[model samples]
Target: MSPANPFTRRKDRIDELAATAASPSGGIAEAGAVDEKPGVSLIASAWSRLKRSPVFLLGAGITLVFVVLALVSPLIAPHDPAAGLLLDQVRPQSNPVPGPQDGFPLGADSRGRDLLSRLLVGSQQTLIVGVFATITGLAGGLSLGILAGAFGGWVDALVMRVVDVMLSIPSLLLAFSIAAVAARPSQVTVIIAVAAVQVPVFARLLRGSMLAQRSSDHVVAARALGVTERAIVFRHMLPNSLAPVIVQSTLVLAVSIIDAAALSFLGLGNPNDRQPEWGQMLGRAQTYIYDYPHLAIYPALCIIVVALGFTLMGESLREALDPKSRR
Candidate 1:
């Protein structure tokens, strides 16, 4: 056979090598194909991180328990929450069963109402007020923070100054003042007060997060690509900054519950005397402290336990969300 040209022979050998490299058994080629689906791999990596986080598991557990409690209280309560059984007034306390005078397992209040039932019902009110207030505060604060950070001039100064003013005053005093000034201590007024007090805290947190995010490479790239200011601020920066905000919001819910109870204890919430609020129950129980301590004790304990649960969840969420804590 005639000898192939030198260049052509070299080309044939290269082609053979290329074909071999394209085969499935080629380790480098197989690895390159595997790298194509990065999104799926990224999600799996995130799930792995979540699974490793003890704080995340604990927070999720606490949140689930409370959600179940709120949903099943009606079915779980042993007695009618609104019914007053006079025969069950001031019964002796027992763990397993209600005494003859006990309206329910938790004993009766001064009004002969079931303490257990009232607590079950009161949980709904606490959750409603806390959740709505936190949502309102988050929305308002996030808006202000985004505007301040994105604009970074007069707008920033104005928003920060307002936050400073709010923070200067004691939060409880501010809530109390707002509640007292309202025409009536309706649930709406209580919600508004709680949200108002929370706004400054949320604003500060978001503003700080936004300041850090504004300098990030992705944000800079988005800006360079001519993304609209609003879109860059909201769609791009907001989502990335939400981890800390979510953690803060969890703590804020617990704080809101405590604030609402304080407002009610000061006679600035749930206008009706018969309304079964934990704080209001405590207030009423004061009159029967000597004769029936269980009235106050039961409600107080319920508040303590519920607050403790939320506090633990908040701490867990904070630790889970914090990068430093993870490290």
Candidate 2:
């Protein structure tokens, strides 16, 4: 111990540094652990962003309220939506439409049905029309998009040409033409008319998205790996191309509802007042609009609010899914 060996002291110092670095709380180890953590998926990341966004929350809230009302309207409706219980209160020459009364909170429509109850019940029809029409359109568009995207060349040209023709026409006018062909006005006809208008929209959107993704690194890699064309198109291209389509669906729901209402307003919808619908109610209200603006106001307000909710939800979703928004 007269003179401590320099080599041994150096060795001890080296061992001490190694132990410190190997400890659980060491800076290097901690950083390594973080680096090893799995990354969040696109869907999960988008969902998280949506949760924190005020616009998403507001849209979700409004959409939820309408969905709930649609589901529970029959159980909660204060009166038979089809019954003209306030018939006595409504007079053609005098009180065409009754104002808010004791039982009728929002007043009665021109037909003497409880406005509040009809509105509550009407939610079901409006939602049905929008959802069914969107689904139908999505299905038709997916078929055409898949064919075009997977085949390109003449197939793509043919499909796109048809889509172009559809898009060239004004959407409402197209709906009107389709609806006018039906033998009689019915809910089915209205759904078909609305769906036809949306098909080209979804087709164009999906086709464009697929075309963009076709030349991406992933597609090239898949093709190089000898992946089947079908698998590449459906498994890779189709799935990857769905983001914009999904966002468009939400916006389309709003559009479908509005178009259905327009069809109804133009007398292309069901003539039976027995089955109350928001659009049908709105259509009737137009007759007494000037004299009793409330008749038109209530249903009109409902359409705007519900459509606005979907639009907000769609816009928020678009922003959330945008790569530019990623931190």
Candidate with best TM-score? 2
lDDT of 1 by residue, 81-140 (tens): 777664443444532223334335666655566777788877777778889989998888
Which segments of model 1 are wrong by more than 4 Å? 1-59, 87-103
Task: Quote the positional error of residue 175 for candidate 2 in Å.
Answer: 0.8
Instruction: Tell me the deviation in Å of residue 127 in model 1.
Output: 0.9
Output the TM-score of candidate 1.
Answer: 0.79
Tens digits of lDDT, candidate 2, 271-294:
888777888888887787788888
- Distance (Å) between predicted and true CA of 265, model 1? 1.2
In model 1, the Cα lDDT at residue 46 comes to 49
